[model samples]
Target: MKQTTVSERALVLAPRGRDAMVAAAMLAEGGIEAVVCDSLASLIDGLNAGAGFVLVTEEAVATADLRPLSDWLAGQQEWSDLPFVLLTSRGGGLERNPAAARHLEVLGNVTFLERPFHPTTLISLVRSALRGRRRQYEARARLIELRESETRYATLFQTMDEGFCIIRFVDGPHGPLSDYVHVQANPAYERHAGIPNVVGQYVRQMVPDEADGWVDLYRGVLTSGEPIRFERELIATGRHLELSAFRVEPRERSEVAVVFQDVTERKRAEIALRELNETLERRIEAAVAERQAAAEQLHEAQKLETIGQLTGGVAHDVNNLLTPITGALDLLHRRSADHDPRMARLIDGALQSAERARVLVSRLLGFARRQALETRATDICSLLTGVQDLVTSSIGPSISLRVECSQDLPPALIDPNQLELAILNLSVNARDAMLEGGILTIAASHVRVDALEVSGLAAGDYVRIVVSDTGTGMSAETLARAIEPFYSTKEVGKGTGLGLSMVHGLAGQLGGAFTLTSAPGQGTQASLYLPLAPGVAAANGLSSDSTLMEMEPLNILLADDEQLVRIGTAEMLRELGHVVHEAASGAQALNRLIAGEPIDLLITDYMMPGMNGAALAGRVGEINPDLPVLVITGYAGGDLDIGLPQLTKPFRQADLARSLYRLFHTGETLPTDCA
Candidate 1:
């Protein structure tokens, strides 16, 4: 297509010979482009050539045929009404002359000037006419842009995934804004909301049972000029929708633009997940009860052995189930780091459920006395103060919690995590015992234990942690068997019967003794007596200060049978500035060591095909006797006498860092019997 170009120059017409030439020269001197036309026919040709405005004398129009000029004026575009400046004699009064008046009517946009006018005045009039013509050209450009914009909007409206609609508020006989009339709707509006041919129809009329609140919601947005986003179930459509609504402006009549998406699938998934967690919790409880029942049939010594075996098997199975769940949730948590707030909350909920399951498994293992303990010197006063808020919240608002610790209390050697769990378990038990409101006190004090003051402990310094509750006191029989597994006086399904037993086992594992004192009328007090750690200051565990230490990166051999575990662990090691070589099996790891792979440290899973971690370490020992080895295991209970430092599976990056720091920074070595 040939494009039309609008000219910026003026067209001059004058029947008097020198008048037209003189006008063109004057426009030229004023920096305006002008062309001289000899007759009406030439003037029409110049108009078709896109002149900005016309300059002509009264004599030119009076002598020329007027029909062609009138036709040209009528044929101009809607946006273009070419300006015409008419020069007349000073006393001529063109209004009284019928011929001149008729010519003026032909030129739709005409400006008159007396012939004796100032040159500046003529230039000013010409400049004003050109400015008006330029505005018309601008209007034409804007119209073109508007047309293209509308085309793009139409395409987006038709193809968008979310439903979109614009509705103007409609007045009823009762009041204004009683309902909204759908003025426009996209294809997705019908598909997602299931309302068809909705344009130009009032909402109440289309959906007769539509909630009045929905109408009021849009009305509120219109009045407040505020946008709202929410999720709701549409009763009419039988679908869950996430809606975002905003007021459309020029709001004489209230109008709203709504964007919505059907989230019924997401809603269903949330419900299914909640139900799955409940089912899993019930299964775990039932399994624990079943194992406890079987152990009751055995002799006292055999029962402990049988329970240990059963606990290990259950722990292994549970760990297998939790491995992928925790791993996948960890990956999901990382992926959703920058996701929307709602998605982040959903991921956090899933992770919490997985963590609860892990805690349940840990409790079971603890009750069986099979869970491993990772003990360190911990300040008793600091640990109590840290968990004060948690303990307070765990007990309802009806109960009061008090924490008291001696200022000079020494550090106790214990596993911080297990001790926290034990204390939390005791607090919950106390809460349950108190039907009404009561006071729960957690206090720590330094005490000296004489001979036989505590079982399996010599005379030395100790920190005594006492958890006392002013709840319903337990009977003598209840107190005597409180530490026995599956022994509970609470109603069925209300208690797992393992809380106290787990706490007792945790105390024993930490080289501490747990004792409960209670009577029929008085409240109960559960005490944990832990030997003080020697040569460790109370500030050591409580201090948050850390300094970055420079250390040389080591060449490490990493082995795991599980691909995901291996990849995750290897990434952690590499992030810590170590060079890692991965092997899928013990045999492969041993082969690498034997092949002189120059491994400074060897980390291998305890269980693998062809040869186990212990066997592989034994072979590596022969190849390089001084090579440091760390064993990683998912097993709940087993002899860790391989004499190598062992870390439990599903450890965090910090855990790996600490282990490496202890092995390298402290110049520690595995026992010589690490084979």
Candidate 2:
């Protein structure tokens, strides 16, 4: 405890008699605290705990082991150099005594005070040693502060997101400060520059061509001691870098620090946007015109779509009304049977007028695209030739007619009746156009077409039928709306606008196209392009015996929502010698079968109230899979794909006979001879 108190001042070690006590008294009188250590271990312990200087006698360590003291002295801190004042005997200095020299070597920072020396000399040496020890503590404080600052710098340099690098200018063969080498880099250096392991890379080796620009830019910052911020492209790596550079302190080292980010994509988008704006003014007018035209076409298309839907609904109702009228009229005509000549003539006129109504309804159905087209392979040249006489009569005596059909013209896949009607309509229009007497030409030819040549048809063989007349042609405005339903230029009663529309609708329904060309002064030409039928034309092989075949009575169920249609249809069926059971709706029709009624054939109107004909057919399939079902539809029956025979509404007894013959004899389509 005493030695620990004294260790901050001086430690006294003197094994010779009265020496230790004397040195202690001398240091105490000089206002210095001192502790007397009995052995070398105590002195070493005092040195470890804390001490300013050591006062020791040469005799104390002369015969004692000094390795412990030597070991303690060797292990001092960098800022520590413990001072020692040695008390040597007379003539026992380092030059004359080898042991004394060895002691001097082991105990460094020592001052020798010989025996019998003056008290003033001893105090002066001890005070000087204490002053030297105080300076070492100040040095230790400075070293600690320096290390902490370096640690903070290292942490920030490695953790920043911006790519950072330090480059030092180097003299090269080119000139002074011509090149630079990367001395340090952060973790983000590789990401921004796209170059890995770049800490030791030289500018010349990394990008030789770009080295001069980089060196010159950073060199300006280094020389001028001003921070520079700019963006530039690195040619070798193909990167655009937004960079900020500043000269580090002590510019003589010629080092610069840089922080950067990659800006390649942002720069490219900016360039593209600038280029688009430069040319936008030149294209605005044409773009608006095209958009206006598209809007008009779309408006016309939507109008046609709405009209087609309404027409289909109206056609369904009209067909239902026409059914009873035609049936009653035909029944009346047959019952009269020439009882009176005047009565037969009146009935015939009424029948012909009803027939015209039927034709008009069919044309409406065609325009609506709801007509069930019976497409077949027919020779187009023969079809054109067949229509020539009718065309000649319709044109009257003033206009001449010409039919020029090419030889070996291919058969087209189309509904022959619809094609005939379409050609007749075209001839009528031509006749009307040639009021002043002009030539009307109808030409038929086989033409091969690619996809781009036709608007609607794909690349294939087609039969083109062109009808032309030398007459007052239509203007561009009239030609544009020529195919729109209910649009006409003729006096109100002179023409129905649906003629061209029905032809156009038929072409679309049969997968074909109708085109017209006309000018104000020149004659008009109307062309119909029908696709060539696949393979060869199939013959309608109805047996001659089928013509003489008699139809046996069918135990039939007739279902209809309209009472008049059902009553008229049932009477006709009974007149044909078939017993008919009637139902008001599809549900009632289905209930008859479920109730075990004797029903050999089920004939139901396709559109009915509670359940539709297709739904009723599906239900009937579960009850009697083999029952021959005949579907009668006022609406379009083409969508009814249940593999049942269909008879369109307002059909005569002959049409009904033909449909029934097909169901009984063959599931495939039969010839019209059965009718």
Candidate 3:
């Protein structure tokens, strides 16, 4: 294909009239752009102005010196020869124009034209010369453009922080891996590789081990025609570098260009950023968990507080009903015939149901902190031993119960009854776990704990009691939520799910800690840690103390906000053949005393809307210093902050009778267990 060429600009130097006009007209007709100049001065100016070609008459050359033009043409590069056409006679080619033709052989693509008898010949010569000149001009323009592009690329490569290298291949007869040369290296590459003047050098001498790899890479590209990019660690430079090599095509020479970059800093930055992100994520997750835990604790506390309010009222009302029922039962049993046992059975059934209700309410009150606690230093070993029989009785026949009481177990100050109830609850849970056959182990020991030994436990001596079961165990997820109230593994209606919660609450009330550990197929273990009690003796055995008989009556005053409770309680007192007076509020009860009612005893209900039981007791004591007062309420300590003798709600009639007799008989002295 013949490439179309745009015409070259020509300067027509026609100093003389006829020949100048003829050359300009002929060059123009041949598609050569021609500018006509009328004088030698103008022609010289045009040449100096960088005209592509010159068409000059012989007369103009003879007139002007033309020495400047000769010097300029002599300085032309090998590929740049400004064509100068001379207008002459037919033999003009043979004439030696010394100054004009000087260095013509040294210049490339230079041509000459003889002055013509025919305009066609002149036009043809001018066209040919201009075509050659145009080609030279286009080549020069391309070279300039190439040089400019190379300069721009060089600036980029040298200024960049990354390392860059170009590997060139020399083709050979044997499999294309013969010669490897480092053709070009940017400044960054030179600085990193610690080499200079590396261009056009064999890689074997410049980079020994890298040379073989370069040869292989070049061969691979030559054979497979595939570009490869890879990362490698430069142990010497302590940097990771990425190399990208590809065929610089026309694989006849099997040339490949390689670009390298130092990626060590980027890798380090990535590692650091990942670590930072992980740390931030962990911190955020921990913060969220802490907030959630705090919120759950707050919710639990509020729930317990609400339960306490409900149970306190329930205890008062239940205890009142129990008093009347028991009093009536005691009277009926005393008077009824042995043969007519239907009434007796009826009373017994009602009492049993009432007792069960009382027990349930007591459990509720304990959970809600509405139960009075009598904490005494008691050995956990004896406590565990005492609860063994109860545990065995509660478990299924197929389940086996085992007890291991530590010989030297430390004493823990706790309410024995409450602890027994917790043990029984745990035993029941164990029995339920093993429907077929399993072993339930109850053990007690003295553990000296240090801060380093446990994460959440304090450094001190603790009485450790463990309840382990060989029943089915829970998974990690289930174990995590086992301590939550109302959370249970038992089927609905079989368990209240409050047993363990009650145990936890009682442990907290007794200043102890409770923990459960379980895993799938590993069974479950619950550990209770109670603070060691000082200066207390262990109980002798696991026997309940006999109820006291033969009590003496004393003047008693009882006050309650609820009308039914006051009436029922009063009836019990009168039935017991003791003088009793009733009041609805603390103020009213005080009025009775001030009116010289000769009250020997005072009993007040706690958690009244106004002037609670404890505060009322304090006021009554102020009036009559010798009078002994018993503050009774479902709330463990009542709303009043004052310290006094307290009885938890839902107490049996017998318990009330026993308490009253003990208090009045002891006379003006608070019971040691009341606190």
lDDT of each: 0.80, 0.83, 0.71
Error of 2 at 226 (Å): 33
- Among these predictions, the greatest lDDT belongs to 2
Residue pair clashes in candidate 3: 88-115
Please provide, for model 2 over 42-91, each residue's C-alpha lDDT reduced to its tens digit, 9 standing for 90 to 100.
Answer: 88887766888899988887888889898888887777788989888865
List, residue by residue over 581-674, the lDDT tens digit for candidate 3: 8888888888898899877789887757678777787787788888888877654533335666656554445556667766655654433333
Output the TM-score of candidate 2.
Answer: 0.56
In angstroms, the error of model 2 at 216 is 40
**Clash numbers, per candidate:** 0, 0, 1
lDDT for 404 in candidate 1 is 91
Each model's TM-score, in the order given? 0.46, 0.56, 0.63
lDDT of 2 at 193: 88
TM-score leader: 3
Clashing pairs in 2: none
Better of 1 and 2 by lDDT: 2
Please provide, for model 1 over 1-675, each residue's C-alpha lDDT reduced to its tens digit, 9 standing for 90 to 100.
002567789899987868888888889989999999887888888887779899999888776688988887787766778899988875334664545577568887888887777878889999999899889889878877887899998999899999999999878754877888888899999888887998998878776677486888888899998999999888888888999999888777568999999998898998899999899999999998888866764554475567666876687666655655565655555557686667778877887787677767776777677677667778878788778888988999998999999987778888776788889999999898787989999999998888887766678777899999998889987887787777899999999787887887787777778999998668889999887877573332322222223347989999888777787778767756889999999988888888888889999888777888899889988989999888887665333777888876555455566677677855665333320
